[model samples]
Target: MKIKSAEFARGVTGNDYSTQDNLPQIAFLGRSNAGKSSVINSLTGRKNLVHSSKTPGKTIEANFFCINNLFYLLDFPGYGFAMRGVQERNKMVKRIFWYLEFTNARPKVIFLIIDAKVGLTDLDLEMLEIIKQNNHKVVIVANKVDKLPQTKRKDKILSIVSQAKGLEVLEYSAKTHEGKENIFKIIEDLVK
Candidate 1:
């Protein structure tokens, strides 16, 4: 599935426009600086589709992007940013949970992005547990694989897969666009 046109729809902080349209939603989530925005930009074939920052916790709200006018790709705020205040972090996490649990715009599938070099952190594992409890279909995306040495890439992916249990974990590199087609295929299948 090719994305012919992609544009920013809106930035949602609550249960408002996200559910108003009733379009299928695909959520992108990860720890701070795990390259969620970069993966989205790579998948869309748009360099600046979603602003990526070097600083962690820059994406404070859930930004929605319309793809091919068929569905919305929701880029959520990254979790586990130590620099942020406790109150702010709690609020952000609450909002994410609210969207996942109470909102009508529950995503068709969630792409849980993680830094391949770092493997799965404690925060990612916690988020995964909550997501599973909510009964959401989730795919673990091991992003930034290009940074790993070729010899170690396979091993790293294997480690993540084993740690993820039965969940499907795709190898990805936003910089090199590796695994972009596989991700597109997953989205196509889920949206259909």
Candidate 2:
């Protein structure tokens, strides 16, 4: 599953281009500042590929990146950013829901990224429930593992796994590229 080519396809706020594309989509979803963009950049091994921001909730639309010309890596706007206006937050949430429930571009799998130290927030749990209700295949990615001490990493991952119920939780570090290969493998399987 080596990435031979990756490029920004488009960003959509509604059912236009997104629904028209038949390419298999791999969705990346998470809370604001959860490192979704960073993980994408890390996986592609291209710095600035996704343009991670220091500010939370900067992504306003679903951005699609074409991967290896085989499928699309959909980078969705982060959810539950308290700093944003209530109306804006709600709009973003509704957009995500629309994509999940109504769009024709069904993702092959959803990668729910989370901060390893923060574990699963209430918002994440809610999102997971909705995603499951929609019957989408999902994988939980515990990003920023490098921030935690080596001794605490396993315990944190275990805690996340427990909280995630039976869902697969992959320990990841966008900074160190740990668990990148495993994620690639999952993507490979799904895209195939």
Candidate 3:
């Protein structure tokens, strides 16, 4: 789908915050530095529409962006960062869960991004379990494939697909815009 217009709606910390006019949503979930922002920017063809950082855990809020005035792209804060103290980290984790659990608005699909170079981590597996339990339709996007060796890409993709069971897995690189067509096609099918 060609993005006629795109812009950040707001950054929210909790579910109590009201959303804009009703629209279908495609949510993103991943650990810090997993390239969530970059992927969003690339998909919307809006360079730097969402701020990205080299530092992990830079996105602390669940930001929403409207796409073509048709649906929302919810950019959630990345988890699994060690910079915060135990209490702070625990609080953030709780808030994230609260938002997911309490949201009345269901998303069309949830994109769970995994860093291609790193494969899957323990935290990622844990989050995957949660997403699966919720019965949310998920599309696993293995990000940063541009950093991986060509030989390893196929193996890594297979590994992710195996781990994800029935969910479709797509390799992606925000830097090079690789695998964007497949990703968008899946989104269109899901949200249409």
Runs with alpha carbons beyond 4 Å of true place in candidate 1: none
Candidate 3 positional error at 2, Å: 0.5
lDDT score, candidate 1: 0.90
TM-score of each: 0.96, 0.96, 0.94
- Cα distance off (Å), candidate 1, residue 126: 0.8
Per-model CA lDDT versus the true structure: 0.90, 0.90, 0.83
What is candidate 1's CA lDDT for residue 45?
91
The reply for model 2, stretches above 4 Å from the true place, is 17-21
Off-target runs (Cα >4 Å) in candidate 3 are: none
Question: Residue 90: error of model 2 in Å?
Answer: 0.9
Q: Provide the global lDDT of candidate 3 against the true structure.
A: 0.83
Candidate 1 — which pairs collide? Answer: none
